[model samples]
Target chain A: MITLFGVGCLVFLVVCALVVARTRDLLAATVVFAAYSLVMALVWQQLQSPDVAITEAALGAGITSLLFLLAIGRTRRTEDEEG
Target chain B: MRHVPALLLLLMVAYVLFLTMAEAPAFGVVDVPSRNLVVDRYLDPDPEETGVPNAVARIIFDYRAHDTLGEATVLFVAVGAAAAVLVGRPGPFATRPVTGTDDPILRTVARLVIPFVQVYAVYVITHGHVSPGGGFAGGTILGGSFVLYLFVFGPGRAARKLSPARGEMVEGLTALWYILVGLGGLLLGASFLANAAAGFPLGVPGKLLSGGAIWLIGLGIGLKVAATVANLFLHLAGES
Candidate 1:
């Protein structure tokens, strides 16, 4: 059951990564990248690396997302080009 | 064009992950090398030799003190580079001009959350001996609270609380403190960062006031890192 859950998380991570890469809208891509980090953190937790998991949660999910959001707020998104 | 290279990079990363998975040990199985070299020494530390409550702290501030110093230097350099690039050539409009409506709900939520975040950050820093978190982790949390404030209150407000000059001063002084500690060891006819040989008093184990130089080193690192990261974000926000 745990293995199944890990696999599910891995799949979600892959999907989120793909979404982040393929999406042209910068805001959407940033949000998807944040999701990717979150899922990756869960995968680390499943691997029983609580230390790495906590670091990932702090860095990957928290700081990276905050940085991305700040960048997005400063720059114009793809959709904003039409305006 | 950009997408092609990105996709190729992703493919490479996936391939590496697959290879790692293939060669990986079973879940919860400790690797032999780590078990023998690192874990063994820490778990059954020589009680007669180095009396420290946290083995990890002992390793960080004693055995691997030079590495910690180097890591702190890296943070200092990063913060300096970030400031140089972001703040040195700031235009007349570099100041973050507030242009948005201040939502009362958002402000209230931030006011509520900031205190808890600060408390948690302090807890993580002080309890590094008993928990998985240490200086770097706790420092990042503390830095994050400032980042949260920056997002809600704008860069100008955050800068008032954490000025660039003060941040730089703290970072520089922390680096100096680390070096001075190492020098103290050297002056004692021991190698740099020689915690045991330097005659640092190893107080009662498992207490907050114990761990000799380790606790002080952790505090130094925590303060330096928190200031460094906060300054980086502040400079970036100021530039934008």
Candidate 2:
């Protein structure tokens, strides 16, 4: 039997991932993805791999988000009319 | 078009996650062969073999110092590449003058915290053999402090203290130092990064100076990674 808390966390991670996929603004999507990584790190910690949790928090939450933000800064802003 | 591949990738990831969960080991059980090996032999080795208080540091810096050297080199390369891309333009300086109003509250907080942040960074690096964190974690924190400086003081002021060229030099030298230590083992007829095999003394376990060549390797990696990440952000902020 799945606990309510586990179900809630899984749903939240799914929602965050979907939002990251659908967001039009690249920077906003990067932030959302960072949040998703944080949730995943939490799940990893709950699974009792604190070392994996730390790596996820560092690489996923920190460096991956920074890389995305930098890439967004380098590129020209997407035009609203281009869709 | 582009979204097709991304969507497919996400689906594949979800499928993999489902499969992993389905086949996952029971909670608290050791399943993987490597995990079993590590738990059986090394987690709390006999005092004769692992002469250290912190087993993580002993594993990372003493037994696996070559991997640490390689990790530092990776960061050094990243710094070099970022500098080359961001600072290599040859036209007359294109930097914009700083014109934003400085927030006194932020500045005051930064002034109060920056010293402690730096001190903690050094302490974390030095005390790797006795604690939860080692060079990489401490180095990331040090890099984060510089990022905080960029956020509060603006890129212009931060750049004066940490120019891209200087950061590149520090990254290069420290990376060389890390690699040279590993190479020293080779010269002594042991495999690279063989701390005890290279004749360094693994001092009393819990002391700051113990763990043979681990502390030296940690210091080199800490300096190199901190400079590399700082340079990465500085270049991205266009201060290089």
Candidate 3:
């Protein structure tokens, strides 16, 4: 069951990564990236590195998303198409 | 086609990476060279040597403290550089009176939830030596609470609670405090950041007051990180 969960997390991570890369809506991408970080934290915990897991959850999911949200708030929410 | 060359390059890079991975030692194998005597020295000591039951904490706060200090310096410098770029500019960093929401639900929930978050952050920092979390995790959480406050109550009130000047003061002083603690080891005839060897008492391993300089250093790092995070948000979000 644990192995299944870990595999599911990896699959979800790949999907999130792809969506973040493809999405033009920067806010949506940032939210998806936060989900990616959350799952990555869980993966770290499953790998028995709880210390890394905590850091990942805080730094990756919490603070980074906030910073990105602020940056998005200041700038355009959608990416501009290149000429 | 245009895509063919890019695809070929990608394949070549992937092949090279796979070759490198094949050459590397297997993960989680005990007999690997990566699992050397140094690893054993850290793991097998039973917490008596470092007085930190958490091996990860022992390694970071005690065995390899200089690297941790370097990490702290990096955070400090990054914050400094960000402030330099943001403060003097006329864009996002411009001072503005915060427009706090009058939403009663947000105000009520924030009032109710923020204290518990602060308390949990304290727990993560103080119990670091014996637990999973240490300075960085706890400090970010502490900062996150302040950020939530800023989000709900706005920067005017948040600034009153932790002004930019006060935040900078806390950041610098906590860093200096970490160095002062390290200097104590040097003054005692041991090298910098020496814990047990410097003649400081290492109490019972599992206790809160156990890990000597480890505990103190963790506290300093926690406060420094907390200040750094909150200050960065205040700057980025605009302070009153």
What candidate 3 gets wrong by more than 4 Å, as runs, is: B92-98
Residue B114 miss distance in model 2 (angstroms):
2.3
- Flag clash pairs in model 1: none
DockQ of 1: 0.40
Candidate 3 global TM-score? 0.94
What are the per-residue Cα lDDT tens digits for candidate 2 across B39-94? Answer: 66556754346456667777777666667666666776666666676675632323
Please report the candidate that would top TM-score against the real structure.
3
Backbone clashes for every candidate come to: 0, 0, 0
lDDT of model 3, residue B208 = 91
Runs of candidate 1 with Cα error greater than 4 angstroms are A79-83, B1-35, B43-56, B91-101
Individual DockQ of the candidates? 0.40, 0.24, 0.59
Point out where model 2 deviates above 4 Å.
A1-11, A37-83, B1-17, B31-39, B53-55, B90-101, B186-189
Clashing pairs in 3: none
Task: By lDDT, rank the candidates, best first.
Answer: 3, 1, 2
* Chain B global fold similarity (TM-score) for predicted model 1 against the true chain B: 0.82
> What is the CAPRI rating of model 2's predicted complex?
acceptable
Q: Superpose all Cα atoms of candidate 2 onto the true structure and report the RMSD in Å to 1 decimal.
A: 4.1
Docking class of 1: acceptable
What is the lDDT for B87 in model 2?
A: 77
TM-score of each: 0.83, 0.78, 0.94
| lDDT by residue for model 1 (B63-87), tens | 7888889889888888887776777
